[model samples]
Target: MPSIRLLVLACVIPLALGFKELKHVSYTQLPTSISSAGAELFQGIEKGTADAAAYDWVNHVLYVVGRTSHLMHVIDLTDPANPVRLFIHQFTRGEGFPNDIDICGGEIAVALSANREVNEGHVRFYHTYTRGSGATDVVLDGYVTVGPYPKSIRYTDDCQSVIVANEGIPGKDEFNTFVNPEGSVTIIHNERTGNPAVQTVDFRKYNTDDAAAWPYRVPSKYIPIRPTVAEGTEPEDVVVSSDGRTAWVTLLENDAIAEISITAQGLGLVNNAVRLPRKDWASKKVDTSDQDGGTHRRMYAGLKSLRQPGKIARLRIDNKDFLITADQGGVTSFTNAKHGFTWTDATTGKSLAANIDNPELKANANDVGYLGRLQVSSLEGKLFDGKNAELVMFGGRGISIWDSKNFVSPMFDSEGSIEEYTDSFFHDIFNCDYIASTATTKSPDTNKDTTSYRQGDFVSGLDVADDNGTVYMVVGMYGTGSLILYEVDTSAKVPIPMFQNIVRTGGVEDTWSTLYTNKKLGDLHISDLGIITSDQSPVDRPLLWVVGAGSGSVSIYNITESLPVIPGR
Candidate 1:
């Protein structure tokens, strides 16, 4: 029989051996410059700058998309410590706004939104490295027209095709009337060839009156003017299967996922759409009120949350594929005060209390420190119900992992871990909004108001890396500009995610007055993250690249095993 001391040692030794830490190694800022067309780029620095980034493992090059800047900045990461800004490629006025970018097979694909989001967009292709004599010269292979508001772009694992998600957001026309375009997924085949074939898949077949009977939630409120289910379905992000045979798109506003089958001829077939399960807060903890003084998490019965995922990534474990989502919720709200037209699917709890029939719920809604300040989706709930009203909120407030084969329920969910982690280590700035500042309208420190501390941690960017046989996941907190690392153990019957370490990459200052100018490793609003495995890294170790939209900076960190080796064998 094992002694008590030996049993204790066995448990303690594994805990100590599994320790890990993220060490900040290098940082660089995206430069703001005037385009050749004489247009000033990245002018609205406060609005955000860097939006997305992609890494080239072969050449050790990094490509960053400038959201407000309308430029693509290329940097050399040969030396992990000192990243060199190689050059910048400016997109002309006709190219539109670049939202996301992906690289494969020495080719780069960029998803660009039209000048008007409702109009048609384009996907421009370029060489990863400049072919021209000049270092700043960029060689454009060609461009293909895609659906409106192209938000995400990715290359298939085989590098034979590129998939794009066209958001197709509704907007007003010259007459100030709403024009809602049908959202779609565009597949470009033979991308490496000079001429590529394009095929766009739409949801017209699901626009019938019986659409309500469909499996997914087709909310009519998304497009009030034209409530067709096809136009209401917006694709936020897309991820392709490892074998490049299927693709999944996240319909954030609708709380659904659309699966499309990809053909070898570059065509896409809309197979099915499944609704994500809503989380019941009755058993889970959530901090619902921004008016609450500090991090006060509580379980509220009858309150449900939508897992409106903003980003999706595919991971293969034991020959099975799993989809991970960053449930950063969103609401459809449009206000044209001049035109006296205001439409929204969101409302404050205080305003909703008037329609609540339950006595206890009504009281909680009225109390400023409880649910009064929390914003919830009005599209749901029983506002019309004479007796009972259910509270439906946006976002899962964390991450969820769903089996690719089964979309009904998630295999694992980090329901309250994100909030608990932030509250435990960053209590001073718990649930802090990255954009909140004294100069902005959402300022929390203007009069020493602590409302911003209750906004909750917004998990935005996520990526997974495999070090040998061990799988690891990294999550980026947009609100606080922090990163959390978790080790995914697949040896169990069901995969288990163990929290390993959390690090604050952004400024630690409690106030926004000095947060952006404090010269931190990373800044606020982490828009995207990429991981370079030890095999692909120049330093022969794992590396994490984080892109900050608020501060327009790119930060890199080294993932090191913090466990000390035994003195002797």
Candidate 2:
């Protein structure tokens, strides 16, 4: 489980006592050594965009939570870029807008759902303190009801336990159509609860293995009824395992990663699945250019890509266990895209629905299993090998590593290096609103779609997180409104990174989000991440916080520690 080789000096190291050493380079792409301490230092709650953050190292107070209004803002970071908001927690009537929040010891926990309804979800809990109380009377000391869309929340450094990720999407109707549900994870022991002790878990026997009727059948005429292979599967992110009873969850539309243990005879699934990996895109390394022009976004070799990992981070390294994905690639609304399926161009073996104008793939087509959206563990004749057997698209824009024993082993993958480090640091305008999403932005005459667009630095990454508590940063959350940072692994031997910053917290200039802009501030597509550690952070280190559903704003980044200058030193 240790082979990865990309060579640029590769490996060599000797002369320790006489002092020659130096060789762990790391940085597969765009990172031009600029950490004038990585500027910005702090950018408080611009009114809304802050999705899930937590801190209170005793009373420094930070607890954010608001991706789209519904409120819960308590800043006062002792003053980091003018933070002092101090109070505002009116979720008013059974939660739903808050996406994630967590704080241990004094206890906080948030996570709500029902934005669309299927499990109607919930997870509230509070009590950060009340001895001297009064900030408008803070309430809700317990609430439990989870399943539908509960996004993220955690606590396990002995806070007694609490976790939630219940993504289970699939709730649509009113003629919009959709309903998958099955994704789960919701524990809450709270020292043996008397009134707050739920435990959901579910995975539908791990998605039935593989049923068939031409893609999970749903009024299928040719495929495209959206076969999520059943048990619906969705669950987005949850970490927890420094021995805290194990929990991993991250089933981003099933690229896979599941575990969930919580013992003493409670929770379940020690390995619901593991999967992950698909960036073969012929091996150009990756840049999945979808907007023609940026020179067709690289990824060479034989081409085929897929690395849809979103939000999942866990670390330990020397005691073994590791993981850090955020390949951020997702999409699914399937309900007859005009029913296409029945092609079979297994890379030219022929019959792409008679190749009329190309488009017959019937939703990804799981490696020839028909009905597809990625899950190819084998097959090559009908091409499924590294996926992209031909056409290409689907996340992995960068940030990966796993081997929590075997979450599909093999580590380090930031190939094409974060779109060549966002083409040397975003001057703005890249991925121009995601251009038809892949296969080199099209133009082979597949009818009218022409070509020549722009935005191609390749960001699809959705979420990933890390924080050793005091300082060991590793985050990647980018649906384009950036947040990249890396550098963790001082020892324990493997986890070598070197790009210290890529900040863009709020997606400016390319526009596309409006998210309850009551106070106005939007564009940080991030999804989730919240870090803390500080007497001041920066050179004192640790302070990451990101929040981006509608991007109302809350983008703090400061993880400096770059120093590398050895060559003839």
In terms of lDDT, which candidate is strongest? 1
**Global lDDT of each candidate:** 0.76, 0.50
Query: What RMSD does model 2 have?
Result: 22.1
Candidate 2 residue lDDT tens string, 1-569: 22443421132121122221111111101111122464222222233445566776666666666545566767655445455555666575456767778878777878887656555687777877433355553566777777787877788778777888777655454455555566678787763365545677775553433444211211111133443443456777888887677888777655677777787444555455665756664454433323233423443333344465667777675577677776665534333431132322112212221322224442323222221222222222124233233443445556677777665544676666555544445523344332233323321112111111111223433323344432254454333555555444335466654454555533343223221222223333445555555443432445555555433455455454444322221
Summarize candidate 1's per-residue lDDT along 338-411 as a digit string, tens digits.
22256777787778888887888888878878788878877777644543377778888888888888987888
Query: Candidate 1 clashing pairs?
Result: 42-69
**Residue ranges of candidate 1 with Cα displaced over 4 Å:** 1-16, 35-45, 130-134, 174-176, 220-224, 337-340, 383-388, 435-437, 440-455, 510-513, 563-569
- Compared with the true structure, the alpha-carbon lDDT of candidate 2 equals 0.50
Off by over 4 Å in 2: 1-53, 61-107, 110-122, 129-140, 148-165, 169-233, 237-251, 254-280, 286-300, 312-325, 328-414, 418-473, 476-498, 501-529, 532-558, 566-569
Worst 10 residues of 1 by lDDT: 1-10
Query: In model 1, what lDDT does residue 530 have?
Result: 88
Alpha carbon lDDT of residue 384, candidate 1?
Answer: 46
